[model samples]
Target: MALAAFGQLNMEEPPPILGSRSVDCFEKLEQIGEGTYGQVYMAKDKKTGEIVALKKIRMDNEREGFPITAIREIKILKKLHHQNVIHLKEIVTSPGRDTDDQGKPDNNQYKGGIYMVFDYMDHDLTGLSARPNLRFPVPQIKCYMKQLLTGLHYCHANQVLHRDIKGSNLLIDNEGNLKLGDFGLARGFSHDHDVNLTNRVITLWYRPPELLLGATKYGPAIDMWSVGCIFAELLNGGKPILPGKTDPEQLTKIYELCGSPDENNWPGVSKMPWYNQLKSPRPLKRRVREICRLFDRHALDLLDKMLALDPSKRISAKDALDAEYFWTDPLPCDPKSLPKYESSHEFQTKKRRQEMRQNEEAAKKQKLQHPQQQQHGVGQTHAASHWPAGPNHPMHNAPPPQLSHAGGPSGHHYYQNPHGGTPGPNRYHPNGNQSGGYNNQSRGGYSSSGSYPSRGRGAPYGVGPPNYSQGGGQYGRGQNPIAGGARNQQYGWQ
Candidate 1:
């Protein structure tokens, strides 16, 4: 009895890992996509045979231990619970390979890889929409948009900002369920509007005017702007409403389509630090309805509210869900009724397109090198002019443009209309200032100070001042804390 009591008194408990598993438990089938911070693999659990996506955390360039973005994503996802949001099942680690001279395990526990496991999604919005000859019906578009807004509403209510909202970041399952993914750029903001976040976020095409104008003190309104872009893209038959290559170009496109922001419209627009530097000549008039003439009245109304020039005036996700467009005829179809599609992802589809381009270049070179042999063939029809059916034909050498990255520069290059002409009416003039207003040819980068983009794909907006506060706040989940408004002073917003 004495021994039992002593054992109970002195027995040590195991470290509380919370049932953390190892990556060995899951079998990686193939790589499906890549995010800003890691490579995503389509994996399956060995025991349960449940398919999942394993996002391998990138560590090569991290001289300072694990990435903070990954940590924030894991923490924010833990607090969020919604069907529209991507479910982060659990974190799994690889077995360490480091060993001592005696072949025993070493002290280093961080040598192995780390992976975040999630439910495997069949296709991202970009890939699914890119499939040629696949036009989403009105009902289907409504269903997807509703799901997106519902998920976004949940995120906003939780105070989490998904700064990067684009087609590629939205994952869709075969059952027509859409979920918000890629929380690497996400941050938890305060309700008091006391935090200042980097304005250089979201892809160039979907970015809002407020962000482009260098407004560091922002809120959920920024995300609504992106939703507005997606809404237009869906209604426009999968064409991006505003596709811009550079920062000035992006803002110009926004001005042309949504109309230039002025004191009359956006009030306090001239107060933004970069406003004087970046503001372009006011357009003749707002063209939201004129540009989207084919769209029904309800869609135009909702889009105008969402893409409001004033961030304060922008529509909230909750209000967007209650818009008239969803209540009208041809209501959203049941998600179960949506057709199942084969697995497709942006990474795989983009790679295939790259290979096709290379093949085309090779064919062009062969034709140039052997001009005589090509013209001398008696029965050789005009293969270049027509798409031949036979496998041997050069026209049939590659896939049929299955992957369409539509956000490619619209007013310019290769993104011509199906009718073989530049985009009608929407095409922007390089020098759009006919009225003789602020016109500056020397444009800058994504930062408020106007610098060049240096982080490449890793930091699409380019690195800026640290986002979090030094002294941990209420929302600090260990390393990542809620951003403070102290940085706003630098940009003159405070």
Candidate 2:
């Protein structure tokens, strides 16, 4: 079902799908992608050794039988026989072991192990388009678009509305054939004009103005608009034409580019539920020629028709396939002739490699910024243990401040001498006093009141250890600390 609303429309239930293959029949490998209804795994069939994607259906709250989404998908996929659409090979399950009085097998565990096997695709349109190294050429783009439109045409002919049409849902096998996959959000378009459908279906970026304005009776025009977006993205090297961040922003961007719609363009647009919320300002419209100048006239024309703001004006998938753009030069190439790639998981590989590179660069910068910090941090740890009483130890966060030695101003950085131990308060007074070690505050060795308490003897009031109360400054004893600087005298700098 549609992730944002009720999916399938009222219709006769399709035939029940039955399968004999058990879960053990396929060897589970790595997970590839996930969906709203199930987790898809890349598995190998034990009997045929054929690689396939197995979608495990979530059977929670299934008192009403299987999920509507799975059921609809199984029914629709089984009937669709187009090569442009992903083929649902079969259904498989695990009945578990017997747990009954008569030794009969209870299939309760089978609920969690049901799988929908599908043909293995080598890549998806989203993944391939995201490959930084792969730029889709004109012919390649045309080829993919042809296949996409052809599939959509088949779906439309069968009255199946693929509401969720995005690049990731388009799978590509090794032969380069593109197939429409993921029908969970698909539903039959009722011919009854009175029946109303949910407006919310396609992804925000791909959603049309009609849906954005809250119209609930939209038709195939909604999907055509998404196709237009995909077409532009493929041509412009993967950059979406309108990559808005929110619903309001998406509407604004769309209106800004397509020109504001009114009764003349989209009849009764203002009457839509959300119209007043995001009133169109009727801003200047952005033409395809200006936005996608690289596209030739015919291609641009087709793009314009597909992106027509009015649903009635938009081209049908069948008609689009017959557009002049396909008949023009650099014609659509054969899908089989397209370049072959490694595993369909190339997108994931490229993403992880990019993340690894970023992490490595960040690590290098950190090392350069703090080369020897680790070793210094270790030494500080050892020092912290030895001094236990040491004030605010360093954990390599940053270098410590400076302090002058009480023995005298023999040189700067007396505190840097690791063997000499910390200077000032730590060395002068065990009580962490001369507290203002560097700023020279109270209890500090430097005198105040513009005068020193000179002992007028061998060692000037030196009262600590190593040279405490004993040895004088480097100048020895009985000498004036300074020969005399009037400036030093005035500022009491000494």
Candidate 3:
């Protein structure tokens, strides 16, 4: 990936170039903040006469081409249209002057580009948490937690996993509506695909225990673990629940607070890659009261379920929405009803624009001063063979249909009997058993051509598509089932 090249060699290419002229419908306002990969600016939509946020990514430092994370973030945002998630209006790729002499084209111009257009928002939850006088009321904190969970639930249901779930990634609009942004660490899962080979994703601070132990075949449970940490942070007034300088230290802190995992609590805990090397000497036996004396009992109870060491036992997004903590008092306000401000309290909207222009100029100067690093010819060869497929790959399609609208009092009610008490035809018919036109295309050892009939019942969870069907052939026993069509018989079981 281009990112890999940037890290491996010292390159002197000017940082990615920002477009001189804003897009047709938007007028560049001001620079708000700078990030590892790019700078953010406030822009006004000329057509709608509304303000929006535009992030410009620098590609000059990149060795191969565009960063994979950026592409992944864009893909996830384009398909996800939710109230609690940030909206991506458009992506602009424009040419500008090149800073590095060696990388300059015959015309002495840079080939790098920028991305423009996004919904404008105020500060992130991280900044809000740092304010000393802004003691958020219980009702208000609950409101934020509920919105965060709701957004997470939406992402999980869509089969999109957000590896990073921190305060900085959560943005609050002027109306105080919290939306999930920064999909740089997000990944999409599909039933038909095998697990990827990489285990390097997510920020170290919010990583789940399973990930810390090096388990690669994880699911939405990984994300749930981070959400649990964020919940604890909220209750503690922005203090991290498990703050460690390194992976081992973080695990030790978690064990100290929640108690060590035993066979009964987590069946496969001992077999993880790093399990033996960093085993905790003390087992966790403290009650919730000892951890945080000041936390509300009800909120603490929810946090316990979310932070469960056993991924299987962790509370799901659907179940979390039904928790009593959310229903007790100070109900969440509608996203559209939150307060909106014309300008940020820290920086006047106009001044921010001027700074952004200045930053761009400074970036160009820095690029010109640095000596250009030689590019390996190998990058061009690798780029063609490993060109990233856009968002439409079969393996990257929408998540399996969720059991939406089951006849239950709450969304969590379906967990009581996840299978709905009816087993369907044996689509995987054992060895040599030709039950459902078994002799078709081969996947692993099973026929991929056979059609599994889908049985449509009332929505099982009131979130995803209705009814579970046996679609993707079994990758292994006890493996998570993938979604199939409505006509396939795999629908009846679970």
- Per-residue lDDT tens digits of candidate 2, residues 1-494? 22222333334555455667787777766666543444556677787767777777766446777787777777787766676777777888767542222334434444335778787776777656544335566666777997798778778766788876766678876555777877877877754645688875666667788887888887788899999988876765555566654678777888777888777777877788988888766556655556565566777789889999888889998678667776555566655456666553423433444455555556566657665654566557653333223233222112112422211111111001111111111111122211111111221221121121223211111111221111222111233233323212321111
Q: List lDDT for all candidates, in order.
A: 0.63, 0.60, 0.55
Between prediction 1 and prediction 3, which has the larger lDDT? 1
Give a tens-digit lDDT track for model 1, residues 378-409.
Answer: 56754454332223334322333211232332
Better of 1 and 2 by TM-score: 1
Provide the TM-score for each candidate, comma-separated.
0.72, 0.67, 0.61
lDDT of 1 at 64: 86
lDDT of 3 by residue, 447-493 (tens): 21112221321111112222223243211123333332432233232
Scored by Cα lDDT, where does model 3 land? 0.55
Model 3 scores worst on lDDT over the 10 consecutive residues at 408-417
Candidate 2 lDDT trough over 10 residues, lowest sum: 412-421
List candidate 3 stretches off by more than 4 Å: 1-27, 46-49, 98-109, 191-194, 286-289, 333-494
lDDT of 1: 0.63
Report clash pairs, candidate 2: 122-344, 462-469, 463-469, 464-468
